[model samples]
Target: MTPAQHNTPAFHDLFATHPRLTGLALAPDGTRLIASGQTSDADGTGYVPGLWEVDRAGDDGIRPVTGSGPGDFAPAFAADGTLMFLSGRDPGERGGTGDVALWALPERGAARRIAHHPSGIATFAVAAGADTVAYTAALLPGATDAESHGRLRRARKDAKVDAVLYEAGPVRAGGDGEPHTFVRHADGAPMDIGGQGLAGNGDTALSPDGSLAAYTRAPTDQAPDTNCVVVADAVTGAERHVFSRAGNQYYHPVFTADGSALVCQRQREETHDTEWRVTLVAFDLASGAETDLLPGFDNWPWPGRPLPSPLPGDGTLWFTGDEQGHCPVFRRDADGTITRLTALGAYGSLCVTPDATTLYALRGAVDGPPRVVRLDVAAPDQEPVFLTAAGGLEPLPGTLTEVRTEAEDGCPLRAWLALPEGASAERPAPLVVVPHGGPQGSWSDWPWLWNPWPFTARGYAVLLPDPALSSGYGQRMQRRGLGGFGEVPYRDVMALTDAALGRADLDAARTAMAGWSFGGYLAARTATLTDRFRAIVSHGGMWNLEAFQMDTDMSAYFRKLFGDPRTQRERYEADSPHLDAAKVTTPVLIVHGGEDHRVPTGQALGFHNDLRRLGVPVRFLYFPDEGHDIGVPNHIRVLYETMLNFLDHHVLGQEWRRPPLL
Candidate 1:
């Protein structure tokens, strides 16, 4: 290819058009590797997904296995090596069902819908030996059969009713009617493994024999906000609570090879004095006893997915954990020894060969997009073999470096600094300080949204800092921010930002700050505390602590950390960003989604009004159809384009270039 043709597309354009890989599923026989691939539609307004066969040997490349049109995702494999996935594609000319159903693709024939539900299948998994499918659906209350549930749904739709009546339960975000679990044989009717509901973020696994299914069940008793692990007889539809605790959250249940026990993660509830402490645990199914698998490990196993050892009846598990700056795979032996597996980049979507010899995962780095990689699990110290080329990521326009600093409280703070190419003492790049969201999440892996490449490609040095509350830094680092939002997290972010700007390759005078979600709160908080930044961008941020505690989706969880807003009046007022709006002198850009349940859009509206009333330069970009995240392809382009324009006008003293499409 020519030089210009070989160049990577600009960040905004690439995000809109790039063919992306998501979710990996390995066949039981380890003969096929399937993954969901999404490409931009004709209008460039959304992504259309289809399953692709990924060559495991790295000799042949990836090829599409499904036809185009509507999106298909969440790929899985039945015991017989049939590829199954969830899709919204309708089988008949009845138009569309408006809900996803389970579809199976055979080796010699076309794909066909196998199982479906009235409320649609939320997710599904198949047994490793019998092809027994376990799926979750949202069923109406008191509806005994699918016919009655379908009638109730139709009636509600005809009446234009959109109200959910929760007699006694804590409301959850993005929840529909009520989640119910069901299991089915390869060619038999689905049997109800009835429960109150599946935990919103819980996962399910089926035994190799397909006799039992394990999943996290939502609290149905007096304990309003608790979750428990339950194992159900797939054939008889009977369930028993294998593990439950009053003050702990249990999730991601995986059955052992022999089905004698389950490996899961337990997280103690967060409180005012402590952050979340998570531990990998094993529960004896027959005895109902729990054991701490990682007793003394300091780092948290984020997304701590437990996988059964490939060997028959091995009783060992493999999981992933975040430590320092990289996420690595770790194996727990039957003798309680923990061995670190792969060590280079952040890894996810882990799958192992049938022989327990090879491991495959999507490895990602700050400077590159995620791609399939293979590792020799038998040899733990070897580097990974790249199976799939990094799609759409040509050479980055900059180099990614690390920034280390010490917080005032003696805590170590770190950040990823991306300096534009050719940046030097004579032509230092303008700086952009971007803190990650979740406050609880780290910037150890490559990020699709809130990425820094767009800024780095524009001759700006971006600083992605893992502040006090950021994960991968051990429990003590998270505990340092327990005092309040404006305390250690803010101090750590500013410390790292200052350290990055102190370097001769960065221009401190032309610096801006931006973040989304909790990071957005920190960015707005920084605006109130300092005028060092020329511009600030806050997206989906909380402005008033009192209002946030009252209106957020997880209000109970919020109250647990900050106490009741009504009783603890001082704490609410002390850290609220809106209370200090008059102190902001920098130009501010506010972005929010109307349907954001986590941090309500009112936070943005109120903060914008307060800043505007204080005579501060502010602009608001609102997406009424969007939720906590702006998922639309065109909207993503506009989001980044507007952000770059705002930074250019404010920080670089250039004319604002409004996106013509917007």
Candidate 2:
């Protein structure tokens, strides 16, 4: 008997059939590890997520734990070793209520729904050492119990009322009815830990003893809606503000081992001259004093739910942070000394064993998909031991190399250049410049959606440039691109691109550029500024800066970055890509998700309209059901197909044949 072999060069099938690994958790006993895996349905139009169990000792292969899936995700283990997760499976299919509910899977029996709510559970957290769970769900203003909330939900549904009424400006959407946090013991009725209204997209945490619960909420009194963290008594529902500043955001609270302090991330407000910075801070529960945990550490720390040290009540913490092109684990001891752990590949879903001797994380690089890896906590410099296989990936069809250049102001710019196989001086591969989103994010790890393999496999060279606003390069790089999107970031991108093109294996004359979100904005902006690229593609990109400043999901954050668009017209006029639509001569393919509120679909529509009226060769690919990022499996196919087709015609000098599915 033998296993089956899979074929390669299946670009469409790659996305259609590949199983994606996300979100990881370790059982209390530390013998089992669980990860959420999603695979495309038969038709590849949607994805069904399930839970998979991985052997901690790497002896047995990975196995599935949940078969009847209605999208099980956010795997976590209760202290009693019960596997807990959230699911939306239909009642008939899996005894689920068809609403997102908290389910528990005991080690000896089948999984069962433990907590049901009229409104689905948005997010949840379990105490590290107690049978306590805290979760958030939506309930109408006057509704108390599940019955009352169900009535209210029915009333709204009967009236077909899906609109969100905003009594103020900077309106946003999504995240269910109205959110509130609750806590519960094993098989006990949940208690509402009363506090200010929870933010639609904020996180919640439970103290190790389950005595305190922390959550975040947006300020109702102000326009720039930044979150403020609040601590509530799990039993009394009495709430107290932990951290709240007018222009800052405090979120993702994690309780210290002794439960006397809370460590959380703070997103500092940005001005026209400075970009936002995210760092960790600890709040002393006794005095309500805020202490900057890593004041001298400039890198952005990817804080996981902190794991206790080998000693029970030690205040030592473990987390990951980005440096250069890799994300490494870092340890902050109880004495405030910081030490860097492993020094390769990016990491996520980090967890530690109960004994605190070994640490586990999903490690991936630009050249490889993520795999489960374990490291000895005491040996910080030792290489990680692999526990699960890396996504069954073959050798990359291309070669990955680093490119470096100096920006106009002498700041160092770096990028990852992936050259297709057989690219050489005599036959240089055509180039496609891809700038990452976030402007605050880095292109350090393997990205499933915006992956470069498909393009490289098709004989195209992909350039991933980390420009001025990219992370891992420290504050100076971020501060250089603060005032507007058009100036330093754009120059940094061009600088890196030029350095890549100078190589003998990349064709400079035959090139194109594409991006998403902030990168999308850069692509659109670059199309207007340069005619070097034969084609341009912008997905979920922003065009009109003024309109974008007012309509995005985090409009207040942008408002604080750049002042009122009405009053501060200089920044809008200088940076808005829509303002120079008439200058775009390159053929353009505009892709946008109709439901995208982050960059918004309007940016695409307006850009397309202007280009069409000006007789610029333009095509618009719109997905009405998608959001800021395209998640639908089939839509993902159409996106790549259309993009490749457009590039083939404009950059590769091939005939334009639109994808049949589109």
Candidate 3:
């Protein structure tokens, strides 16, 4: 296919239907590679992820391994050449609509269901040299076997209890159920390993020899606010104490190659002033020794990137860390030494060959979208070998360039500028400035959720600027917005936006702004502070700081940023956007996920209500099924559609209309 076939002046279907590749899995022998990706469903209402076998050299076109009707993932090869994966193919799950079960596909036969659990399996691992499998399942308290678990569940349903007694755990609005890791040999009896795993979790790992499993146990009544990393013997179900520090949280436990150590990330608040930086940690099994990997290493694991990008093999661990505007690969040897292997761009969704000779990852930068690449172990920083054609992606709809500016305080700032074709001094394109989230995050890499390609296709220029709170800039830049999210970052954003507007091809009069999370908060704050832009959109932003402090998951974390509402009321009033909602004159679009606990739905609902009460032009979009990030494909489609429609109506002076979401 050609770029012309996919790109057009009108709404491009490519944006909605393009194949998205993620989660790569390498076979034990290094000869076969399997990948999992989501494609547009038949009804075009959602996405279904399926497994595909990728040719090592990309000679043969990628072939689909299993049908897309049922979502499949985590494809692992067993020692007996049996491939096992988790899927939601069966409708007879334990009352959960989309609960997953283990399915096996032999070397030369069709796939069939291999195992089933009452509360459904969350994650699983196949033994490398042994014929055992380990997975996590939610069993009823005081119930051992699946049958007893089911009986107790039935009794609980029959009684119809509404209140739950207090046992210390994460406070959320739902039933309090715990997931426990279970081990079993393939086609044999399963044994329950007593450790409280997170519901719908993914931080469990099984050793290569199938003798040990490492998992993160959520804090219980005894330890109210601390996560415990427990390593248990698979066959005996004997738990041992590794290393844990007070006031520290551990997660993403993976067994070392020799099965004598566990590698994971440690998050702690060393002080009350600064944000936590997750560092690599190792816990030895034999001596119960704790080793801090990359001691004093400034960089952290790629923020907001799901799944640890590196895999450990052959007594070595390899992973990605964010450093100086790039998320590169780092290798850790057994002797407590670390080396940087790759540079210059962000890397994620990584896997390594069985022999550990080559590394594979989906890499991208501000100029391009993610594409699969292969790198040699010896010299990973060398030019990458593109493994796939990336579904023959179309040519860039616009030109991408970089912009540099300095804040009033003399802090240097960087931004990425996307200008549509035919933009010139005589005909400047309308601009949309997008600030990143985390306030601690940067726009150093390409973003799938906030892709600028669509804006460029519509003859608009998108400016992604990183302000004082951005990473990769150094500690001084990070500390600039520590307790004052509304002050320093605001100045930094205005500086960069003013610089971008100075360009001959950008139209400041017709500009708009949009963002999600902290980005969304900044957009709302910007709208309240100035009337330069025509419109504003805030997706899942915190509008009321005092109210948000109570509803969010990390209440303590938010408290650390902005002090207690009673003690530091002035700061709350100074930083919050909703407290000054009456000053917001710009037309606004407020979008939020109803199930979001991070920046609760009330944040958007309250803001929209206030804007309406103040006689301001505003609209609200809510997705009940989505969480912090909108994951459902159908909701994502509507989100992209509504955002464009809102921008077109206000910024481009088109007729005001609403999308089909009543």
Q: For residues 124-210, what per-residue lDDT tens digits would candidate 3 score against the true structure? A: 877767888888877656777677877776788789964554344455623525677888875788888765643335467787789
TM-score of every model versus the real structure: 0.95, 0.95, 0.90
lDDT of 2 by residue, 546-623 (tens): 888778877767776778877888988889989899899999999988888788778898999999999999999999
Clashing pairs in 2: none
lDDT of 1 by residue, 1-662 (tens): 00111125566677567777776889888988887777788887777877787899898878877442356788988888888888887886222545788888877677788998886888887887886999887767777756677889898889998787766545553335667778888789987786546235437778888998887877653564477888888888777655788878787877777778878888876677878788888888778889999888888778757777867778667788887777888877888888887776788888888888788888887877778888876567457888887776567777899999899988888889988877888887888999989877888788877888777776788899998878888889878888588777888888998889889878889999999999899999999899999999999988988888878877767777778877887777777888888899999999999989899989999999998899999999898988887777888888988998899899989898887877
Better candidate number, 1 or 3, judged by lDDT:
1
Off by over 4 Å in 3: 1-12, 66-69, 91-98, 155-166, 173-176, 197-200, 220-225, 269-272, 303-315, 333-339, 444-446, 660-662
Q: Residue 506 deviation, candidate 2, in Å?
A: 0.6
Candidate 3 positional error at 295, Å: 1.9
The lDDT values for all models are 0.80, 0.80, 0.74
Task: Report the CA-based lDDT of candidate 3 relative to the real structure.
Answer: 0.74
State the displacement of the C-alpha of residue 263, model 3, in Å, after optimal TM-score superposition: 1.2
